[model samples]
Target: MDTILDALQEGRLFELLDNDKTDALQFLAHIIEAFPEVPAGTDVVGHVMKREEAMNTALGKGWACPHARVPFDEDLKCVIGWSPEGIDYGAPDGKPVVLVVMYLVPENQRNHYLREISFLARALENYPGLDKLRKVEDLDDIRNYLLDLIDVSKEPSGPDTRARMIRLQARTAPETLVFQDLSNLIVEPVTLVAGQNTEPVVLTQNHALFEWLDSVKDLIGRIETEGVYQNGGWRVVRRGAVNYQGSRIVYDCVAFKLIQNRPEKYK
Candidate 1:
């Protein structure tokens, strides 16, 4: 999972002028230059441009993920650019684009490119920060947050997937507990399909948040099954450091409470 920071750790992602469309193209060029992992010359840019022509990568809500695949001797690389003020990207919303994530993949590695696309799109689907990015001043913070989001989502079978599956389970009711077992967990309740469905679905911000929540769930499961209920001699232990700022359980608990109190829409 290539994070926003993973793409920008060495100052790889750039923040360019909203009006500088050419710079966006140049930004792609720079990624090729910086990472020899990508193929050289017009081929790289042409691949990117060709993809752009196929469908404006400007995914709405001020975020665009532009990507291309070409023959490469190396693995893969990503280039990212941000336009916090938003750029006049030819998008359906015409709201301008604030984030641009570029991907360069090897021609033989079709699966890798698909995985990258899926990972990023899933993160942005319920992203709670389209409004927040408008005000954030620190680029590192944004980069790190994005990185964490990607890292947590890629896990196949683990507590992270379990926690996400729990949230997925909660979709059955008009209101449900988006609970997690961890302490000081960051949870953001996303009211996705707010009006489209009669039932309220609890959407999480990203997989990292889910991973934290999943860990908590595991701990809780251990307590219920192994310690509190089954074993005769048991002691509660603080097994892991709690990051209250981004813990999923703590954040989702808040969301659950709010949903419980709020009026439910019949339509």
Candidate 2:
């Protein structure tokens, strides 16, 4: 399976004329027309429209992902469109959608299709490249900016990039823990509170972990994991433990073993 960046390069990327006449369906139709290799007799626009009717694909913050599954020979095909003035996408936040990324995947590639959407959504949720994308006027520059954004997402977590796991044990309460990481791969913190007397509580600020896991899975597509690691592909490298403020807090580092071998590169 090709990475999202690879598929994007193989597909089309262009800018749309932002006007009072443009709507969601028109935007989707434009993308469908851009791809000529879509199998004959395939109603690409209808497929996408049907999916949209089922659920609004508009993700707030000026972004929308409209996808369709079709009878195609290839795993997937993508087309990214940018509208500077934005369009009324009926988003949850009621914000105009400025970016539309449409995916047309083969029916058999269910897992790949889902993974692609997940990655794209998470990548754009807090992407730092949006500002740069808005500034560039040329099509080639926009493409390069997207490639650079993907390159940054594919960066390997190094020694400096670490997640701090804090295990907090209270006096009467059983125990609670938090995983905080400043890695470029995931910038949010995951906190889990568990104990015998109290109900378990989980506080997640964002989909950072989900995004990282998906990216790693895509990087190691279909690879066998025999000697990868005894503990299921993840190895918790011990950093150290510490006691603080009436709680036993343990600090440890977590990383994916498979990612160490395969560093991402854009060709």
Compare the candidates by TM-score and give the number of the best one. Answer: 1
> Per-residue lDDT tens digits of candidate 1, residues 1-267?
543433443345555533444446544543443343443243555677777778888777777777667665455566666676667778777877777777766676678667666766776676665566666565555554455454465534233443444334434435422222211222243222112223322345644433443334233444223211111111121112223333222111211111123222211
Lowest summed lDDT across 10 adjacent residues in model 2 is found at 159-168
The worst-scoring run of ten residues by lDDT in candidate 1 lies at 250-259
Cα lDDT tens digits for candidate 2, 121-170: 67676577766755667555665566656545543322112111110111
Model 1 segments beyond 4 Å from truth? Answer: 3-5, 39-42, 151-267
lDDT of 2: 0.48
Off by over 4 Å in 2: 1-4, 18-37, 155-267
